[model samples]
Target chain A: MSPQSPNTKSLVEVRELTKTFNGLTAVDHISFDIYEGEILGLLGPNGAGKTTTIHMLLDIVSPSSGNVLFGGKNLRHHREEILRQINFASSHIAMPFSLTVEENLEIFGRLYEVPHRKTRIEQVLEELEMTSLRSKLARTLSSGQMTRLSLAKAFLTQPRLLLLDEPTASLDPDIADKTRTLVREYQRRFACTILYTSHNMKEMEHMSDRIIFLNRGKIVATGTAQEITAKFGQRDLEDVFLTVARNG
Target chain B: MNGNRIHALILRHLYLYKRSLPRLMEIFYWPLLDLVVWGFITVYLGQFESGLPHIAAFFIGALILWDILFRAQQGITISFLEEIWSRNLMNLFASPLKPGEFLAATIIISFCKVVAVLIVSVFVAWAFYSFNLFVLGVSLIPFILNLIIMGWSIGILTTAIIMRYGQEAEVMAWGMVFIFQPVSCVFYPVSVLPGFLQTVAHVIPAAHVFEGMRAVITNDGFPLPELMWASGLNALYLLASILWFHHIYDVVKAKGILVRVGE
Candidate 1:
């Protein structure tokens, strides 16, 4: 699918967002807009502020001197209201281990206050191909299964904006490819906007509608995958990432 | 706060308790052991005919009441610790669940657990030792309420510390309330303490609660003043603890440590 037009409404507007720890800035003055129904890829090296920025967008991390407006509403003032329409998934995050997969989804479904919760949960499980594992405890699932469960939770809410942090990091190649396709299909079906991050260059090019590359807490480049590759005078995003990491 | 969100959090913990035998056993095992041991001690003490009248009531009642505070605090702290241990804190905060709603759920869970502990302790005390906790009459309501609030205050404070400092501060989850036990006079009178320590005990809500509990047992008349002092102190401490938690929450967010808490 092609990227959303510039004229498309902005679902999230991050203005001069910055975060400092002690004297070191983890996310320096940075800003971007995630257009509605577009998958915005946040690409960066190991020390980049991609996760920190995602945390700020989720309001789990407070910016040093910036604001995030979701659907034209200030996140600080309307955190609960804004968050209700958003969901996040990360390989580094997890559900309650002792709870079964279905129970975990049930809790999140209720947390998001989705209408017809039981039916929604069943549908989400089936969509994620986790129907057979619904009764299995979270701790007992393999890493790939855990990843799918996390994705199931993200899709369970049908969130207006989904923030995914290296969500396929733990999945095998086949499962990862399927997950990418699933995400694309979900976004297409529901017009759900996503802010996705990953170290997989080919996957980034395949999944992101527009890519924002960050280095040392600053955005070094932002454009479509081909545009970014051409702008950096590199063969692909992998080369561009190397150039940014080594030369910047 | 939305009731659905609060119920979701409560349900999350309830599922954990429902599935794990160890978790369910924890709620009854420790309290029952404490009751059995203390019941024997009280019985042994009764054989001596000491000047302390109703020695069984004094010891057994104090043990049961003390469990109320411990279990109440654990209900909140351990529930939160479970999230941390499971690496699920980020998922929870990232959801629409507000901090106030989260605390409210823990408070309700604490109440339920406290009731469970109370039933087991009260019944076991009556069955084995013929000690009826209801002898304190209606005053039992305020006593339990005050202890529960105090437990919540300490639990919230511990949770804030753990949230900010991560696993390094987790020791507070188990140890923070016990620090109050020395000053709380859970078994002895506050008069046994040094002057300065006595002054310190006066500020603690649990201290007044235990003192009042003893008064009620000894028929020294109703402990209206002690109850009022405890309620007033609990009001102040609970407010202060909640404010402290909010402040720490903001600081953690600013420091960008919320995402690193479980790690």
Candidate 2:
């Protein structure tokens, strides 16, 4: 992984973002910056606001008391302008099941207005090793193939800021490793900044240049994997996660 | 609104229709069934009364026009429900596609579906029962346009309700348009309704449209005032429904309903 420079630009600036449901606060007034060209892993247990934070960044969920700025423009005011350069993928979300793999990507490519859309779709499919599944319906794919297809969409636009929430949650170890390697290589090649969340601590350690740990809707730790491990007096990220999850 | 984005959304649904037999069959099934059943019923009634041909025209014409409204509304609502069922709403919203662009695409799709159903109904009505829909002449355009606009209004409002409330409110997609049917006077004159319902029917754009259709068939000259009222009411309802949808969209985003909408 490339070292993140202190002077590096922040691709996404989330300030005092909070989301409340009924009487429950899903995310508190937490603030963070995802520097350009760095893989920032958002670590949290279930219901710890990891997905909620990602949603706020994508503007899929509105923040109750704060704002998110992408490329120095407020997301609320410049939604389409900013979102054109950004993309998101999650295993929990899906494409039109009845549509074929090529058809789905064709739609998204046009949606993002990617120039030379046809070539880009073929390139993404080949890069994700999904060329064989191009004509197959999305509903016919296995869980692992579906995850790859979602990743293929994330990679399709070569988005500057890709927010992926548990993207590899359903993938097997072999494919999951390849996905991580592919993401790292893509970030290195394109200088794409990613805000990634996953339950796999080892994968988090392997992929992230910096990590933000959240618990109970608040930021608990922010550093490199080793730094967080030492800060929490734990052996590694998994132990640190356990410490936070059990104690909080 | 970007034209490319809107085209992409429409293309997505087109791909679905192209691939699925059941979905393709849906475009022709309901409208044809309604036309055939009503054609035979009108024929049966014609055998019993003298000069019932005009009455038969009213029944068949109303059936065709009412189907236009129902199909138009279904085109928008069912298209939205497809996204929900497939869990693809987030993908579209997360892209550069704006809410207006999304609605524009769906409205275009609805218009296309309405055209398809109209062609089928027009052909069958002329072929089977010798009842010509074109007898309404150029006034037919505005009548059809009015009903479509009203359908879009109701469809947009239903989509807003479902967006805020999630799948639990999906029943409204099919049922909501029917709620306006009685007041719409699709099969009878508004005067036959209760006094309060007659008053209610006056405000509905479809009600004026049906009344206008009957006047034209009965050689009552052009129903200018009725068409004017229908147009004015449609403008209000369409504007209000669009505004309501935008408002509910914000509410859904604020409450995080988008995350769990399909589930």
Candidate 3:
């Protein structure tokens, strides 16, 4: 059960969020809410605007016409404050290539104004078992190690809401499990809301408390993994994912 | 521009530049190569060109000044491409940065790159040609203003094209830049150049600055007062670049061109 409640303090609230690319619509009238401490999984296939949605949430891609509220305040009006409380992690986008893993972490930590940034960076490095690779350039890291460093940046601020995009998409089975355990532990330790997106059904089943199915550009279904499986008359979230993405 | 934010961004790019050993070497790499190749050519021609004292001095300053101004814009191309390669261009716009902040950082970083090339060219010129640019310098303020506005004027337009298009436009920018160089009084005095060519030289703002600087420093000629005139043109170019860039950014963004893959 989540320690933070829906009524406690909602961290992120999206109202009729819609993003249009030229004449075509990418994310069409999507709406959702992330409470103070809950793991909200956004699942969809390729080109489903999953990344675009995340971009909108992060205020990178402006919405065509909608409002995103963080802490009950408008994102457009209080972007600086809202951004300070949010951090994103992904393996696809690399940090400064010239800076070592540790240096990259320190720069972002300072940007977020994290208290005792070095101490926090070291803690996260150890937490992710990335302490040994801290001295290496971020560009030099193998995919798995770079993912860990990106995670380290995500957790550097221990943000109010952590947005992740298929973070373990390419990790080995062993490292993937370790990453899942780290996510669980991170949530337990920090009490921040986590909004994750992945196509890995098993990973989502294991890591998410609730999963949202996004198809085309709409939220077609949302429920706990078991509930979604049972309600869709499917054996697993993957089957339900196919049903929603293809049929509905 | 929020000086501190631009400072941070400049530090970020310069720091990244420092990390790549080959790249850092390349900063001095091409200009040094240019100096060696051209210096040898100049040596071969020095005896013949020496008869026209003003033309000879013009060649020396032009050699270094054009290299500085041109190489500075080179940094702009690489920096934007760097962001593109890393996919962090998307990430940067997500930050608390406006377009002005980003533009200012690009200009400042470009200026810093100019300074880097300046150091190398100055040292090499002093060593090889005994061409001390300091001895031939004008009022420090206008001199810097001239180079800065000239560089950024071109830099923004070049960057705007890159942002709107891609590396293909970069080659176009390079071609147009040098097209003006030959006619901009970089190699010979306006007087020596043919009538039509001299008119083209007079039209280029850099020609005015270069010719004026040569006149002041070498000929001890009457004050040219070209600064105010050149500044007017540069200011217009700067305004047009910023607006044109902003308009391109908005049009591309609204049309969703900025989000295209590999764009």
Candidate 4:
């Protein structure tokens, strides 16, 4: 039986999604459904198609042979409508460099057409604790501050679905823990689905309600942290990840 | 296309220009220097003016207008390139912002930059050499409009190429316009080019614009035929460039080039 066969209502249904680059398959015939409000952790070693999957979800990359349905509409046909309900952020992605922090947030907020934009911008800034740096140019921001700004932009839209790629990759341990807790709180408050990725197994174990383990463009395992560990008869998710990486 | 989205994109770029002094300098400095150098030549040549009464006016006027074309093209291409350099293209496209709206914003930004540069270039030319661009009178409006549209056509085509081929094609942003410069007859009449090149020049909108400017300078009455030709050519090229841009945008999305562009 397929992991996605359960009748849980899904906000995002990725059906047979595949991608190839110069004859090399980057994402190979992957299928999954992101539930309405559960946190789905996408786990894979480097080159295992994590980023490619995220890009496909965002329609930044088109699939070679399949379709992605966002909120029951084909992404190819209703990209703008579907994108309006979704927001994404990554430490790898940078906002405009020369624009100030406030300018960047205001611009993105307007693009998303958030209601009551001025009030929302101020609210997001206050939530992120970035009121002091609002005037600073993006080029002058430290990595941690930039990540926070990226988060601010993501939260500004108050999206129904949020895609976060390595959201805590650049932060210190304490902040990383804090951001994870904040993300959890926001997901509950907004009732938004989240698709998150990270290399830190312990962090993934703590935060993910369910996990998908991918290897070489294929999903090698799928279950909760405890279930996946039990499948490999491992002590923890870290050992289970090691076992998959070594044997797959 | 959404107006608010387009305005937001334009405002995003305006902040870059507003925050940096060097960027502002780049907009007005080069054109001013070009006018000054050519103004001195115009004065020196006026002493030997056995042919035309206001040869200096022709040189200075043509220089300022040529910069308008160059600036208009650079405005669109450079702004698009900056997004790639900052790795912000993915973030922008991932939003609800439509591709058409993004392109519209760049075109609007190009117009703003051209206007700013034009005012400064015209001011410095008049202050230094007393070469009044207003000498062309009401006819000057159409002349400027035609040149700016042609610049946008070239600008859209360059941006399309960079989108399809990636940053390796960036050099074309600065170099593409010049390929048409010699044939443009910006400093001379179309009659000066070789027979075949003149045939080639006739197809370019800029050639007709400069020819019309010379006619107005020589008090030959407004050349309606030249203006009509330039306007017609601009419309055709602008349509083709826009179509080509949409095609390239689809190709970029399919190939996933947007993700790797800045790298």
Q: Mind giving the per-residue lDDT tens digits that candidate 4 earns over B49-126?
A: 468766876888899889999988988898889899889999998998887898899999999999999889888987
Q: Per-residue lDDT of B57-143 in model 1, one digit per residue for the tens? A: 889999999999998998988888898999988888888888889889999998899999999999999999999999878877898
**What TM value does the first chain of each candidate achieve?**
0.97, 0.96, 0.94, 0.95
True-vs-predicted CA distance for residue B196, candidate 3, Å: 8.4
In model 1, where do residues sit more than 4 Å from their true spots? A1-6
Task: Flag the better candidate by TM-score, 2 or 3.
Answer: 2
- What's the lDDT for all of these models? 0.91, 0.90, 0.75, 0.89
lDDT per residue as tens, model 2, B182-212? 9999988999999999999999999999999
Full ranking by DockQ? 2, 1, 4, 3
> What does candidate 1's lDDT look like per residue over A87-140, in tens digits?
988988977889999999999999999999999999999888899999999999
Give Cα distance to truth, residue B149, candidate 1, Å.
Answer: 1.3
Cα miss at A142, model 3 (Å)?
1.4
Per-residue accuracy of model 2 over A1-248 as CA lDDT, tens digit each:
43456578888888999999998999999999888888999998899999988888888899998889988899999998898899988989988899999999999999999989999998998888899999999999998888888888889998999888888887889978877888887788888998899999999998888999999999999999999999999898999999899988
Which pairs clash in the backbone of model 2?
Answer: none
DockQ, each predicted model = 0.90, 0.92, 0.35, 0.83
Root-mean-square deviation (CA) per prediction: 1.3, 1.3, 2.9, 1.9
Cα distance off (Å), candidate 2, residue A230: 0.5
| lDDT-best of 2 and 3 | 2
